[model samples]
Target: MNSKDFTAGLAELRGLRDEIKTLRKQLAKLETARDKQITALAAYEKAKAERIAPAAGVSVADVVALAPTLAPPAPPQPQEEPAPTPQAATNAAGRPEPTGVPAPDLRRAPGKPAATGTAPDTTITGGSDAPPAVGTPSSHPGPGRQPTTTPAADGEQPEQVRELPSIPPGQDGDTWFTATPNLTSTRPNFTQQPRQMAFLDATTGVLVHRDTTTRLNLGTGSVADILIAVYATVPATVERIYITAGDPWHRDAERYPFLRDAVAAWLNGPLPDGWKIESTRGRDRLAGHLVHPRNPVGRWQRGDQHTEIRSVGEWFDPDGATPATVRDAFVLLWRALHRHWPDVTLMGSPSQTGRDLWSRTIPTKAGAKWADGYPVMSEEIRGLLHATAGQGRTELITPPKVPDRLPQLIELDRTFAYAKHTWASGVGIPRRITAAAFAALSEKDQINALFAPSHWHIRVTIPHDWNHVGLLPAPAAGDRTWHYPAEPGRTFTTWAGGAEVNLALRNPHTPWKVEILDGLLWEAGSPLREWSTRLKDAWASLRAIAATHGDPKQRTAAHLASRAVRAILLYGIGAFAQRPRITTGTVPTGAEHDIPTGAQIIGTDGHTITWQRDTGFARDPYAHPEWAAGVWSAARAALLSTKMREDNLFVGALHLPPGSVVAFRTDAIYTTTDPAWPYHGHPGDYLKKGHLPGPVTGPRTEDELLSLQTLGRAHLAEEQEHHR
Candidate 1:
């Protein structure tokens, strides 16, 4: 507050004031320059815009009219045209008028300023430089607004440039477009046409055009005609068409048209002979449209019931008529379309396998040219064999010839018989016969020999009762029972029973002929002979056995007795008893006139053997004790003949079959004198009684004999079975 402080403060204040004045002056000058530069820049931009707008096919009026709507709206006026308010602007139509129009009030009222211009402090939409002038309504007045006109002054419209339709979300660019490099409004653009097929006759070489909906008519004239007809008739697009022709079965390559050359090559590849072909057809429909005149734009819709036939039958049946024809038409169609659109789906019957049958034969005359040598199979022919024959071995057609001989002839006969048997069995003989079947037969002999043909016929009839006793006559009048012949230079010794004989022989050149030996040798080592001889030998053997240990006279008696017993057993007599012996004592005796004229004693005492149901000797031992004593004495003498106990006994002639034993007893006798004679009598007693005996034991009663024979055979069979 002191005067000195006041004065100092005043001086400082005056200095500050002078500095403020100078700074203020500099700031004012800078502001004026900036304002001028901004005004000049705005003018330059406006001029540049006017110049560029028309060059770009836009006018200044259009540019200005389309300028950024950066300016704000003015105050609203009364609904009524304020009767030419003195200060308001007016048009030539006399609406309103104004002398000074406020310069667009560049200072924005508030908030954000116009985006069209840039101040050093503001962010411009197009950075500091303006964007190229776009069309806009002009500030000056314009007229004649048309509804479809662009926003240009004077309504001079700019041509409309439309954007191409957007591609369907994603697809190949050219899928919907045709390759038209020279396209123009005046020229008609073209697109690819659909592919079509033309079927051709395999036989007559006629082409058939089959469109989407038409069947290939047999009457089709030419490939071109068919194509035109199909194009005119089908309800589908037509792009490509062609004809095919050929006989697929035949090997001639010149038969098919140009398009089918490749197909023919594939089908006619090498194949063996003796193969037959078969093709099965399908009834499935195609998977494309079929629009005929009656059914325009009809689609070949897929359905469960697929039934349609478009291709000709010749494609499968080349002859179109016969069942014997072989063909591969499917392959033809496949090759024709494979190069183009293989994905074009085909609908038809389920697939089936095809077969080819081919056979080749050389005549017998042709075979004769080879001199009966094995004909070698050609490798070329083998290469063409059916595909299934990969595993078969190549072989000659004919067999080599064998040398002539009896044994070889027998073998040839046997072979012929076998072949004939096979033929009778109904099995098909192969086309080519192999040589091995009758390798032993000479080819020349086969070709020229008088080898007679014979057929086998076997007739068998079994009796209703197996136990029935009956005679089986010999097959022929002179044919006797079979006898096994002993091998030459062999010796045999029979068992005491005389049923079997043991033999020893050496075989050098051949196998033992068992079949012949079995029947030939009744006993081992016995010589083979006629049945009569066999009977005689048998009788002699029995006599020798009887006399082995008996009195001289009684030995003879025993031999006779044995012979009688054997005859009885062979004749199958069941019963008999003692009969008188007549030593020619009753011939024409004084009592002989007492007998009936036709009746006479067939047997008698002494010289004649006799048998009776009851034991009564003409010379009774009681009436004549001496005679009885003599009889007993004679019997004792006869009973003494035997070396072995079994020899004296009634042992079976042969061993029993397996699992059995022969039974006999020396005490047993075949004589009528024996107490059991009536029940168990031999043939001797029946002869003495003047009656002929039946078969030995009658059917099953004599089965023991068969068992005996089988027993002997069984032992022999054991060795043979082991060898087998």
Candidate 2:
């Protein structure tokens, strides 16, 4: 308890204090180490979850193939087997590199583990056998190996050699490409990852392909050349290319023949070796020629304004300079004919229009009759003929006695100016024709109308100003589309193709339906040439009738009546009556030779035609209810052929041999429980039979329409189901 004890105790207290200080220091160091471990664990978990999982999913094959191109890690050779210092390493390209091992500062340690698993692999280093360090290229190749190539030091690709992702056939998706902005990143000196873009291909979906510099360059020249080059370069295994048909430059099917031809040639002929080509046309390219003509000529007016009209034989004669030589001459003559003598009769078959007479000296009937010599008519005669033969002339001209038979000399005058505006007159033969008639014809009688030529060109718009007048063989009871052979002592039945009639019906307010019917009838004959003479006579007679009944309402009624008369005519032409008498032997002079029993002709005025019939004759065999059922059955069969889609009757015509006529025979009054049925009775029935069913005569309630409603719903549901 003395000084010695005190000193010893003080020394013990000092030693205890030193020991406490040392213990505190050790505890602090341990806590720092624990915090670092926690951080490193957190970072490892994040890297595993986000980056590693996604990259791993890329097929091992794809990853390995791309491996050699990846950046290599810095050297980590051990110094005397010293512990590995986990410092952030730099890639060979001097960019900040991934550490492979999660750093203590970045990751937090977990409190506990559900279970301990295998330790992580950390064998990565600069040596060739090391595991691929983060950002470093793998030493060993993986599956689906791609050719290895060195990347540019600047991280910028040469624009051409950069391998783009292979676009999988039939599959559309975003594509990645090296972008310019990332090419030269100075701070990180890192290559920009591929930029995502929508690549467009005709074969591709709505997603578009990015336009790379190479693609742009390929498109720089003539479209045809570019297409050809592209086709040559592409592997032949590719069946077709994805292009833009809607591209503004190549939209018109008519104008870009070269481009289209190039595409076809590429598909069929110019493909690369080790590959075969197929076009979008699929397997039947030849059958598609009709749909896509190689070099389609446009409407008549589209060609040289004046085509040197020359005979097919004369233009091609060995000694002849030919049509091409006389192109300008023919052009001048055409301008002369079209501008000055627009009404001069045209020559050649129907469909050629006026092209046949371009360079030829065609003699008008009057000109030929009045010719002084073999030249037909001289320039002096032409002068005397007046400067413009097409316009109205009131000089005294004798009307030739109503011809016993019409001569086939013809000319078509096109002056249809009133085809658009509403008409002032109530006369409704289609408002446009009414307007044209009023404007072209004088109050007294003369009216301007279409004249048929022996030959003429058919064009999209040419039909607008012309009428086709040629003989078609009359149709028989069984024959609906084609004209039948005329035979004596047999009754004829007339029918029309549903398509033609429907086409005529396109105009909502057309009034010339009846007239069209009549015209159709007069032309019915075997071999177009057979009906030419008779057709002329009929046309002249009709014209006379039209002039006679010029009153609008009367004309309208006459037009309707005329349709029936034409139908009867068609029947006669199809039967053994008038058609046989004219076509079989010689053309008939008048009605006396081959009179029809069912109907009697009363008048021949163009505006109104009269016919007398018993009105109670039994229905034609083709018009019987059984016939209707057969037609419906046929339609159903055809629907089956189209996979249940209702197709046009013309499409079915392929089943028929060439020259076989086709028609869709259906009741004009197509009323049924189904509301979709257009009419309640036949169009011809009311006129011919004088009555119709009464269900259509009365007002009906909405609830009473259950039958039609159910049918329509069923039909629609079927359609939807089929689509699905």
Candidate 3:
């Protein structure tokens, strides 16, 4: 087959190879386009599934049935022309500048069917004729108008714009100032904000208004000057005016009188018709009220009003100086009397005129007579003079006897005695005297008295050899705290005229001491004149009793009896009564242990009796029931048979007030064994051991007890009277 045939076939085979390569390249291009279409269809199916899955609850049959009537997708429309750009504006520097216009939104193209659920652009722009953005917030939007816009010109880019929420008028807007009104019924609306300034007026109530801008400097002005300026503002409204005064203002009014005169002048002066100035006398700044003359009948009544001319500064200083003129006079008189009584030896050497003269003696034919200066004493002295005149070498040196002046002397003596007692007790004037003084003085006067000076004579005594005694540190100036050491045997003396002693005694720490010394000291010019009189009378009566009671034994016996009765009544009864309790065993619970009637149970002392149902009588009168009734009867008879008489002994004339409970030790036989008992070996032998003494026998009920007490007191008073 030859070389020529082989070469021609090889050329033809090369041409066929080139044609096959071209066909293969075209098939590869078609496959690539087909792959692209397949990917697009897959994405579309996925999206469709996602949208339908939310409504999967719908039956598939219903979906298929509706599918036949469903419209096919709309064909894609043509794209619209791009927004036209405006001509560029030239700036002062000759550079092309933006027209401040906004470009159209490319997010929603013109021809592409709008996607469902896509948000509409509500952005605003600068063009007046542009349609309003689809969802622009507007109270009233015009139809067919696009949002105004200013598009960028050729070769220019638009500036970035920020969307802001629109705020309607009347709602809060973005601004620096906000207004809020507090006044509901009334309002004072000013074009511009007003500056607040207080206005002072006398007669008007609080009034607010805004008109004038006159501002006065009141910082350095006098009250009167400020008031005048305020009044000069004439018809101006006022909120309030403050009035105040200090100590000096009242002092000036009191001392100078001209200050008050000036005030009266101001009140009567010509002022605004409606202006009425109310002034407080002192530091009280409360608004003053003027009640109508006929308030109950009047239609309108005046209310509290602020003062215009108010003084606020302090004026006077307090005067703490104490006066001692009366005390000095007393001391002088006392010294003079001491000198006058140079011959008087007894009764402590008469260092003071107020010392008692009872101990003073005058030599007489009858031996000696007391210089008490009683009216009856004068007659005795005359008789003594008559008897001694005839006796040779008989020189009767009689002490001066002025019966008429005895009352004053006695009063002085009593006062000094009280003062001495007060000093000794380490307490100032007693509470009784203080109460009497308080009852007589007004509240204001009492306050004044607290600050007022009164005479005081305090003597502080320490141990003789102990030299540690010294004045306590002075209290801080104006501090009223006071301390007085109440150590035993210490005497305090405060002789100057001041309330310091009283203040110290009145403190809570000193109440007991005050009570102990009550009615001992008298304040100068105090209203307790009755105390002095009563004390003087009592002293005179006592002295007279001493003079008349010649039998010392009888007097001694009576005194002893009186003291015994007082001891039994006060100490035995008021301090020793004990409640009965079962002894030696727990209280019996069963009825088998019958407590016998009249069974004695021992008490501390005294015959007061009490019964315990389980423990028997606490203080039985007798060991045997039969003897109990007889003993009790006898005691009652003995008490009842006794009559109230001058000779009967009792406690002092002072009787215990009614309803006072007298606690006493009940006399009973102690069954408990005691080592000290005389019948210690015989535990039941109460009589041999000697039972406690019984209480006073007569009184039964509280009333009867009180009656007996009254009788005893009367007897005491009678004895005192008889002696006097």
Candidate 4:
């Protein structure tokens, strides 16, 4: 609109046009420099590829071929020479051309038959017949490529073929291409070989090689032979081969000297690639280590059935072989192995050997001789001997000499008899006496003397029925019909109201009664004779004391004297009778009708008496001389004999006819009268009998008799009152 605005606008447009012209020239220069840089980069890459390809064991063409961009495109041929079949593309050799790159074939599944004689198609994006890569994202199907609908064959399981990524040339200053040949076609073919086998002899600990044609006994073969034989025999396909060493292999080392070395060599030597060799000792070896082998490769069948081989060694015969033998064999094997290869891996535990193999392998040093002898005498024997002798060590033992004197002989005989009896009875005899006996008698004498009887027998009479006898004397004429004959030679019989009475006799007469006559004769020569004389003197003394006291009743004096006599006799006879005696001996008839040398006269007081030719008695009559004298003195003062006679006379008087004289004798009197005869007619008759003088109590034991005597002397008045 204005002249000045139009002129300014035109000046600005002219300046702008000049600036645009200069920018166009600059852009053209930049484009020309960019082109030059691209052309120079291509030429530099080609020169680098050529320089390094030789060192990489590859040609420059190969390097260029690896990179598609750098490779020259092939010129199109007249669609005439139809695309070469995989078979037709072979080089001068019959083998097909190697595919420089691995390519997936989608038309045929993996692991399937590659159309007979045709190589696997590896052209991924080249010819019209090339199939599309699997899993490649695409919308339209290419020409001549129909969608595959038929399911793959049963054996046509496909495997994904991964193509290794291409490396750029000069990367890491190296250009290398790894050719992945199809393993299915390139793997070397192998024909299977027959299995070569060998067995270990269980009995001999030797290896026996076997084949279809012949069997060879390789007893104690060299280590090398064993290794080669085993290695060559087993199949190449076998990853692990096991050799079993039997028990004998471990046990008899002398027989199997090379077994250990052989096994070691076999294990340590080189094997085929991907191959291994393993071995087993035997069941014993496994059991010792507590290892159980699984999937045994070798086994014998019962008939024709396939069975696993559990053990390679001997067939174990439990009945014929000992476990100890087998175990010993294992120990030997272990020791051998441990000595050679200390770190060898064993199948079974070595702990079962129960010994430190390594420690045992060390040689032992020689030591001083400790002992050498058959039936060697040990410290225990010495100690035992020392213990036996009370003081000194016993260097030697000898049998004691037989006793000579009659007294000594009798004592030895008695002691031996007592020991034997005690042993037989299982009752413990005083050790002091037994030891003395053993010391006195020789071993032979001891054995012979044991058969002799040493027990005592005392004939004692008590009321047949205990209830009939009370603390009182029976009436003289209460019932005459109850009376029975009591003569020594007569057999007592009785009747009640014309019915024969079956009276129970406490002391039945036997043929042994005749022995009493012999006892009486023996008593004359024994200390009992002296005891009887002393008793009579004590009685006389009691009587004299009673007379001086002005006791008119001679019965009381006689009773007291009789009591003293009885007391003396009881105590002395008891002491005499308790002596050990030999009861077994021949009873000489005529000239030697006297008591047998060691025959015993057993008393009723549980004592025994044996005649000693020298001493009159086996044991001393007065073992307690002072006590005997005191007893005599006390009897004299108390008039014990008189009291005893008086009580006896009183009892006799009560039993005899009313005016008849009843004598009290100091001599021992054997009676056959039954004290229970009168009371037996009626059960309650004993209770009706009134209290009588002197309690009618019978001592059941020797101790009871002593107690009664003591009580009678101490409390005569109380006893008398109770009796009354």
The Cα RMSD in angstroms, rounded to one decimal, for candidate 4 relative to the true structure is 63.1
Query: How many residue pairs of model 3 clash at the backbone?
Result: 37
Error at 352, model 3, angstroms: 52
lDDT of each: 0.22, 0.22, 0.23, 0.24
How do the residues 580-697 of candidate 3 rate in per-residue lDDT, one tens digit apiece? 3232111122422454554432211121221123332233110111111111211111111111122222111011111111211111211111112122111011122121122334
Give stretches of model 4 more than 4 Å off: 1-527, 550-568, 579-724
- Candidate 2: misplaced stretches above 4 Å? 1-295, 298-323, 338-472, 476-481, 495-724
Candidate 1 lDDT over residue span 1-724, tens digit each: 8999999999999889778767766876885665454334335533443444545453332232222121112223335533332212222233322111111111111233111111212111111121222222122211111011112121211222111111121123112222112211111122212234434443353444442223444322422233334444543343223223332223333443432332222222222232111122222222322211111111111122211223222122222321111112222223222333233222221010000000001112321221122121122211111110111011111111111111100000010000001001000111110111111123332111101111000011111221111111101112221111111221111101000000000011111110000000010110001211222333444456545845444344334433332332221111101123222112323455544443434332232221112222332111111111111211111121111122222111111111111111111112111111121121111111111122122112225433433443454356457889
Model 4: per-residue Cα lDDT over 478-572, one tens digit each: 22111221212211111110000001110111111100000000000011222233333444444454446553444343433333333323333
Compose the digit string of candidate 2's lDDT tens values, residues 1-724.
9999999999999899778767866876885665454334335422322232243443221221222112123223345543322211222233322211110110111121100010111110111211111221113211111112223222333232211111111112011111112111011112212212111121111222222212323432233433444444443232222232112122332433355433222222222233321212211111111111222111111111110111222111212222122222223222333443343332221122212121122222232221211111112212211111111101110112112222211111111101100011110011111111212222221101121000010001111211211011221122122322211111111122211222211211111111120110011111111122232233234334445865644433333223322322222222211011110011123544444455554323232222334333221211111111112222222211111012111112112222221111121111211112122221111111111222221213334223333443455556557999
Clashes of each: 52, 46, 37, 25
Find the 10 residues in a row with the least total lDDT in model 4. 514-523
Which ten-residue region of model 2 has the weakest summed lDDT? 419-428
As a TM-score, model 3 comes out at 0.15
Off by over 4 Å in 1: 1-233, 237-315, 321-724
